[model samples]
Target: MRIPQIRLESTKAQIGLKTINAVNNIKQPKADLSIEQPKAELTIRTTPSKLTIDQTQARADVDLKSVVKRMEEFSQKGYQDLLAGIARRAQQGIELMKIENGGNPIATQAKQNSQKPMKEFGLGFIPSHGSVKISYEPARVDIEVAPNKPKIHVNVNKPIMEYEPGKVEVSLKQKNELNIDFEMIDIKA
Candidate 1:
């Protein structure tokens, strides 16, 4: 007689993995600026001075009324004395005629002298000095100023960003295998 026996074989399964990392990117931009400047303004004004002079009384000081009055009073007394002398000479002439008519030839022939008027007169004039007036005014000045301000403007831009998602994949590298075998063997006969 012979005896039979059996045999079996087995293999384990294997796995593989693939992975990708996520990525993120960010960017920022600078801002823009603008400015404007304005100029200043100014204004000025001026006025001139004034002056006045008056000479009305200066001309009246040298007029005729004051000078003539003094002269007339001084000469009138001398004129009166001259008239009286003339009258006395006329009376003496009549007396001489009478003497001649009374038959006196020597009296009629005598030389006669007419009286001369006295010159005791004064003429003087003094003028009152004229007055003066003066007036003056100073100059004046005015000034004004105006200024303008500057204008400014600014502009800003938003930030830029980029993002990417992660990915994962899994696949089999080797399959599982199983084997079974049957064998007959005789131990004793």
Candidate 2:
């Protein structure tokens, strides 16, 4: 009996090589960040105004006019009474002269009717001015005020904006597949 054996072995092998090239369609996302500005406002207004005042003052014035008028009347009456007294004294002088003249009634009446006669040679003195009475009262003052007014006002305003974040997505794609295999043949003896 004879037998034969054949062993299959491989030292080196070169298989086919495959390369894949693919293009992905992608667009840049919209601008992620956003900004908002603050708001401010100012306003001013004004109006004209006016005022007035009245005042009165005096240095020498009577406080009670009615009382002053009464006093004037009294002074007039007193002046009349003093004049009557002077006339009575003159009449008494004339009567005394009549008695000194041995009761000469005609001459006494004539002297009393005539004005007083001045002596031609006698020492007599006459004043230039007569005495006068002075009268006065305290002063008075009064005051008053009136007017219109002033005011202030203020106003405000505001502005604003909203913001949002960006989004991202990820995925995979198949380009190619690689398959390699080996087989053994029949052996006999």
Candidate 3:
């Protein structure tokens, strides 16, 4: 049997309008077996103009959920390692605040008084809590296999602090399907 050609579909959306550009049979692989599939590397570029407020908020919620899921999936030691960097940053911020408010007896006394109440109430050292939601889609793969199994990798790049920048990447696997759909959300400045 002859190998089927691979098709590529690309789409771009700006300001709620979408433009699609596609090319097929761009390249052929050398290997031919019971299964034939194409692996793709996709790069999505986004800016503030392309994103809406609702979209950004939804994305952040998804990201936060993903983080929580990851924490649950990983071992305790691994989760601690993942949070160590964030903890260090928070500690630094607290230290800076302390320094800035130093040498004022009233402020010092207030801090002490506040801390005492917090400690008594067992609410001292509150941990940062939040959720991030992201928009993303799984990759599409079309192939023929005796025992069909497909692995899909979806990489998501997310922005932090609206104007500040960041990214998120997720890899997922699926089997026996050629059509996949997903969305990536970006926070605008």
Candidate 4:
């Protein structure tokens, strides 16, 4: 009888792997878009306003204090002249009427007495005083007028405004990492 020898063996483990290759298309997309509202500033400056008004009335006053006295003097002078003319005309008319009524009485007596021419006798024929000219001057009066002026004033005011916009900030993402995994194709041969 032949005796068989016993043997023991151990095998090492093996792994099959594939490669990893890729292009990272990195684009920092317009750094987190953000916006802020606009703001406005106002400034006001002023000048003090003032106004003044003045009024004047036109007037023309008549001072009639001495008018009466002056008119009276003129009236008195006219009256005197008129009266003198009337008296003179009246006397002349009376004398002429008397002479007309008593016509040729003295001539009849002279013819009866002597038939020849008698001595000259004077008749009552008195002449007037003087040949005067009458004046007809009237009185005078006057009035005056004056004017006045008015004043005016003016004032003004103004306003101003200013506008501005807020600022914008930009930033990017901080940290990142990559990972991978592996496995065996065949086992237990």
With a 3 Å backbone cut-off (N, CA, C), the pairs that clash in candidate 1 are none
Candidate 2 residues lying further than 4 Å off, grouped into runs, are: 1-65, 101-189
* Tens-digit lDDT track of model 4 for 38-61: 443434444444443221111111
- The per-model lDDT (C-alpha) reads 0.70, 0.48, 0.47, 0.44
Per-residue alpha-carbon lDDT of candidate 3 for residues 58-138, written as tens digits (9 for 90 to 100): 444445446666577577778787798578567656766677566665555456546734344444222223322434554
Which pairs clash in model 2? Answer: none
TM-score of each: 0.36, 0.20, 0.14, 0.18
Judging by TM-score, tell me the better candidate of 2 and 4.
2
What candidate 3 gets wrong by more than 4 Å, as runs, is 1-76, 103-189
Model 1, 24-133: lDDT tens digits are 88888887888887777878888988887754444444553455665785689778878977896777767766774676544434443433447897664434443446
Q: Lowest-lDDT window of 10 residues in candidate 1?
A: 108-117
Backbone N/Cα/C clashes per model: 0, 0, 16, 0
The top-ranked prediction according to TM-score is 1
lDDT of 2 by residue, 37-65 (tens): 33333233333333332111111122233
Give the Cα error of residue 133 in candidate 4, in Å. Answer: 38
lDDT value for candidate 3?
0.47
lDDT ranking, high to low: 1, 2, 3, 4
Which is the better candidate, 2 or 4, if ranked by lDDT?
Answer: 2
